[model samples]
Target: MTVLLTIIVVALVGITFWQMSKILKLSQLKNVDTSQVANDKDNDTQGKLMLGFVIFIYVLTIYCFSAYNSFFLPESASKHGVEYDQLMLISLVIIMITQIITQGLLHYFTFKYRGKSTNKALFFADNDKLEFVWTIIPVIVLSALIIYGLFTWSDIMNIDEEDGDPLIIELYAYQFDWRARYGGEDNVLGKANVRFIEGVNTLGVDVSDSYGKDDKIVNELHLPVNRKVIFKMRSQDVLHSAYMPFFRAQMNVVPGMITEFSYTPTKTTEEMRNSEFMVEKVATINDIRREKSKALIAAGDEGLETYEFDYYLLCNKICGASHYNMQMKIVVEPEEDYNAWLKEQQTFGEQMSAQASN
Candidate 1:
């Protein structure tokens, strides 16, 4: 494909230079009309080129959709993500259809109406029917899309307590890493602030608050599959965005303030790893890694390790220099596994007491 594109570009440039040389030569001729106006042959050639370019556009569009379909993200892993994907698919389909119709008509008209000496152009000063059709069609389409999008957004954002007692977790963001603070047992995150940060109190939980005593902070985030998880996001310094791609959830983490996003995990990490799409993606990645490993080995460097599939929590905002490395592993497992893992982590009060004793 690259070679083909390069050849096409070179050919176009060569043709342009050739045409310029001909115009230069014509300009030097004595008593010649050197206005360089397009005649019937030039018009016919340009019309054919316009038709060919439109054909190329359609062909490229079809090729891209067929060839790169596998590169698209797999199915969503959150309950509300299904609706989000549906809305996106609908929007894309509408845009594609509109593009095809509009572009085809535009290029076809250019070719059909190519200038000729015998032809007389028809002029329309105004057409109310045409104006009304174009205006109303877009308004109707845009209105429908906007209304549907609003409903979907409302459903995702309105975190209702009636939708079962959600597992409340605080996602704390710092310069270049993420930390998850779980509300142990009480299922309530306590008030926290940067001023409270000291000793082992990394998340700045107000230790005096009874609700904060049992808050467990950890480097990794884990959630119970099929359970609704509400995340309260906070940033210590600069603004950050907590983005969970697989779950289709993202929210800004502002300094001195907290943002919220909630979603139910529909698939466990293990289940997602075993999915067909994931399996194929992993294999393709490993193949590329193995090829690169050979080069590293030849250069006396360590080979890359094999990769495993896992969901991740990442910073979407370019907060700082190491923004790319600002990510945490997220594990969605069965309820029992999640409970066992949470129980093993030391609470804030315990950590503080241990530090004092030391």
Candidate 2:
């Protein structure tokens, strides 16, 4: 009944608009060009407006690029990230050039050839040379770009097991949080499934599986600098994206299937924090936080904490209401430090046994 009423109301509103349009048309003065065809004056004014609009857009683009340049991400932090950034920069350059040429020609031609009373429109059925020039140019450009992109993609995605004995890890995603599972001494992640989820077994590891007995799970992601790390991703509730912006790494996490991505961290967390770019960014963020903290303190609330630089693993996809808060800190450290940290964490078997004892 509610749907029917909504439909009726929508129909009435539409009909009322139709009637109003008819009345407006009928009410126009007889001398007015009711045919709604463009006249010489109309064309001239519209052409000038188009020209002005194009100029305005160009100025806005320049202003935005200059003013927001500082907000752009700092240099990539992974080995492949350099290549990824290069490809991105090339694509943007090409796009910018194409946009400038096409938009400039479009607006210039619109204004230069705008309709006039004495003008005679030219008609052409076909022009083979023109067609060939337009078609072949785009084909060549697109084909080259596609080929280059494919090669880059292949290089990034090609995970050779023989290469550097990459560390194996699992990134498990859920509605509002993430979990990192490290392959223990065997360096082989065990089998897992959503159905196996139970108390103290959040990631649903196959407890009976020998490979899983030594698996370690933690909330924070830790990577060894200069070491190739392969991440296997899985989602339990809904589709999610595992995004590590600094590494230029992102892969979809789908339920019932394991996705993979790999990258070698080139900088440790402390190294990145100490970099000039990061230092400036951290200072700017802290300044903003301090300003906000003053207001909170005045209202009898504790001031905000000082901002610091840290890499993060974020859920790029909007999975649920709390998706904005779905992130985990990523710490890249020396191989020895990473080993020490991993050694301190309990294995799945130990955790399960302890839970049982309790």
Candidate 3:
């Protein structure tokens, strides 16, 4: 397929060159009488060539834009991208139609008005009907698009409780780290603050509320597949942004207040983890020299393509100098495994708390 496309592109380019050569040849001819020039038919080939080139240009441009705009861009948190894309397409379509119509008309006029032996300029008065048609047509088309854009923008930006679940997750960003708090079994998040932070109190979660007992402060976020996730973002020290490229979501994480954004995670973190882990294992074993290879081979005789893990929480914001290093490994396991991990973290946190109090 690629080879075929390459050949076709080459052929078109060659044809373009051939047409340009003919246009130059025709242009070099000495100025003939206007009547004679208008009567000539060979010069028409140049106009056709110009039209073909314009079509080719539009095709290539549309192809590249569609490929990049649709497939290449990752998802973002802002409901902004979706509507923006639609608006862009609408605008392009309008422009293309205008260009084609105007260019065609201009070309036809150039041929019709070509100078002639007759010393007479046809005086055709402009019709108000034509003027009204042109003006009103654009106004109507633009108004329709503007209304549609506003509707899409409103739908995505306004969180619909009727559509999405109240599954809230508080995301806190530090200078060089990220922490997540799941609403635990109750699915109700507890209050949190930066003032309460101690050497070990990473999230500074205000556990004073009775509801805090069921609130789980998991360092990483574990999302179920095909579920809408609403992120409640906060920054402890500096300004930060919560950016999830895959979900096409982004929102600012400020210190004083909270910001929110939502998206559906169609792909599970487990899938992402396994994919990345497999690649890492391949790279890790590639550098093993013969001396160490013997030991590694003996330890795992089963051809070393063996590590797998789920995807993780990544902070795309620059909160501080070490912002680039802020990330937490996430595992999107089955509900059973996810629950088990939560239980383990809870027990461990409790143990640590007991030891510190003692």
Candidate 4:
């Protein structure tokens, strides 16, 4: 019913606009094209009105979008989200204001000297004062914006772990799959290398290292609230990107050498419901979506929706045909729940290991 009503309303609006346009064409106020006739005082008013209307509409559109973004979206993520909003707002304001001033001046100049009676061209080719003023003003504004953006970017990327709780996780990516390996109860990641990769040991865990035994491969990651998580990202097959739009974080995952990036998750799954950007942000919904969106054939029974959750992972890079299948899930929990979840995952890995031996 809602869809039908919406379609009917849209059709009505479209017909009304079409009729109004046809009526306007019938009573057209034509502008004189010839230079002399175009410069006539009688036609100048129309040109000025057109310019004014254009400027007003352009500025109105930009500001309205900025207002909707800042106030409409709930405060979900911390500095990352808010800074992006503020940056977008400032950028829109700057662009719209500059465009209006430049365009308005151009239109104003067009009419200001459009008199046909003046036979000769103006003697002055360029005004030195005008040149200096415009050049210096733009340079100053551009410099300020660049410096401000750099500082904001630096602050967002800084994830120092001198005092507060910081968890280090290894994120591995391949042709079309993502995986996360938590450091486990010991809180130290076991060594991993591409050269050590075999069919069964996909992650290339260094079994020689005693610590490697306890280091578990959790399909879904559970992060503690408000804790800084530094992910050591590596690509096994091709280049991939680690993207978390909600946190305003993305890093390139290159093969051979490992790339690193970090973000502190502030909003929980319950809190994410209120965020406007959250709808577009995939990190929170990644695991859930992956489980729900899995093909019935690949995942066994077609009726099954939910699958196992593992450490948070995703393939942001379009590597190959199966790139669509690349995904991993994350579950952000309270400190106690995160710890309990970690322990349970470790237990499950041990059980699976024992079963394989039998």
Candidate 5:
């Protein structure tokens, strides 16, 4: 009944609009004027409206940048994140400046020089100087941006192994879930093959391989603060992307191949959670959740829990129906706590040997 009423209301509104349009057309036809048909007032009104919209865009952009700053991810936790953020800011500033100039001029011209039948347009088939100015300016600007981008890419891709003793961790991607294998005290990951994956051997670490003996498989990813983490990524069935927004890290995980990305974690989960901005964000989230939970309870459904800040490893690629659920919790902690947790995990070889004995 409510839906029917809504449909009827919408139909009535549409019909009213149609009738108004028809009446306007008939009125214009009956009262046609030779001098006032295409007046400056109408053109100016339209141009002004467009210019007002542009101004609204500018104001909205500023409002969003300021008002919703806390909703954006907190400060990056990786070493190269500052550089990455600077590059992004440079690109955004360039784009915003160009947009403002072009849009302002476009609307201003429409208002400043409305169409007049007596006026003639200045036409030039070609202007080499003007064309060269526009072309060379963009070329130089784009070339510089491209060169700078290339240097950044090179720096990220070519990591110096000798710079620090990076911890090795393997990220295995499957259809609907993720698993992480940490290279134990040896700091070396053993050979892995998809074919050997069965039951408990989810990551297919070769038990026979000595290095694989100490490989620790875990559901959650744990990283030591202030230490470099080198993730060796792999996929069993389809392509996936490992994305960590807070760390400003993303890398492709291709099937039957290993891809690598390295980053140094600078902060722990507790530190991030305690940050003023994050604390405010959490309060906001919990407030929203409380309202949603009330609605859920009214509908006889489970209520939502309060929110907390935590690092996450999420799959960015759409692999399958369950792709959205492909994620793992990541915890950054002090070296001692991380090592203590690591030691408590069962090694692949130990699990395999125990199963064999059984």
Candidate 6:
């Protein structure tokens, strides 16, 4: 069936090219008035058609913005999320306004000045004042945007180590998996080297460093809601990005150096799951999965299981063949629950000391 479809498509393309060649050869007439080929009547009709198309573009933009906006990630779950959202909204509004004004004038002019045999063409020259006005307007607008962006960028990048008890966590990226390490009471991560990675030292914590002795390692990330969490990110072999869409957080993990990003979790996993937006999202996902499950069943494969809402830490960069599956679960809970879970995890020192006894 695929071969048959390919042959049909190829035949259609060949016919189209052959017809185009014939038309080009036939249209090579010398001293022919170009406007005669496109008559005034045809141009007028085309101008009206273009005007309709402009309206269609406007309608489509409105419809898409109204219907598809809900499909985007729900409100961000970080302390700076509101600021990020406001910045995005401001940019979108500016873009939309520019698009509407330009398109409206373009189509209106096309329709109003459609070709006519009796109409005389007007001689026009460049207007210095008009050019200056256009140039200065954009310069002023862009300057404001640049100034606003600079302040926002500076604030987000500046991390105050002395600020209120910010949890120090390391996000380790590898080929197909992710590992997280928590700094002990000192709230400082020990030095690590890629060479020291072995069976259990997946994150290559320097055992010699006292700061690494009590550092906890975990498969899943757990954070306390409303607590400032600073991630010290590292990569093993290649570049990877730690991206949490919900928190509006992303940072590249370079192989040789550690990168950091800090954000406070404003919502818990359960709170996000139960939110009105997430409830709708889960229902939509389930509906899609149900359709996929039917196709899998027909192919003699196991049907897909129902999906649930959860926060995820995902690799946003294309690092390896298994990059798509490089993800880890994230859970945000109250401070007490997070502390209890943190206590249950084994520390680097305990794990290594136990291995020596074995």
The global Cα lDDT (0 to 1) of model 4 is 0.71
Per-model TM-score, in order, reads: 0.91, 0.88, 0.58, 0.69, 0.86, 0.88
Candidate lDDT (C-alpha), each: 0.94, 0.94, 0.66, 0.71, 0.88, 0.91
Once superposed on the true structure, which residue ranges of model 3 sit more than 4 Å away at CA? 1-56, 59-131, 160-165, 270-323, 326-334, 347-352
* Clash pairs (backbone) in predicted model 4: 219-310, 219-311, 220-309, 220-310, 220-311, 221-310, 221-311, 221-312
Sorting all predicted structures by lDDT, with the top scorer first, yields 2, 1, 6, 5, 4, 3
Least well predicted 10-residue stretch by lDDT in candidate 3: 70-79
The candidate maximizing TM-score is 1
Off-target runs (Cα >4 Å) in candidate 5 are 1-42, 299-301
Indicate the worst ten consecutive residues by lDDT in candidate 4.
303-312
What lDDT is obtained when candidate 3 is compared to the true structure?
0.66
What digit string (tens of lDDT, one per residue) describes model 3 on residues 217-270? 666777665556677888888887776654555678898898877665655664
Q: How far is each candidate from the true structure, as Cα RMSD in Å?
A: 7.5, 4.7, 13.1, 11.6, 5.3, 5.4
Tell me which of candidates 3 and 5 scores higher on TM-score: 5
Q: What would the C-alpha RMSD of candidate 1 be, to one decimal place?
A: 7.5
Give the per-residue lDDT digits (tens) of candidate 5, residues 97-201. Answer: 988888888877876677666678889899999999989988998899889888887877776657779898999999889999988879889998988888788
Give the TM-score comparing model 5 with the true structure, all chains together: 0.86
Kindly indicate the candidate among 3 and 6 with the higher lDDT.
6
Off by over 4 Å in 6: 1-37, 294-301
Give candidate 4 misplaced runs (Cα > 4 Å).
1-79, 111-120, 274-314, 347-358
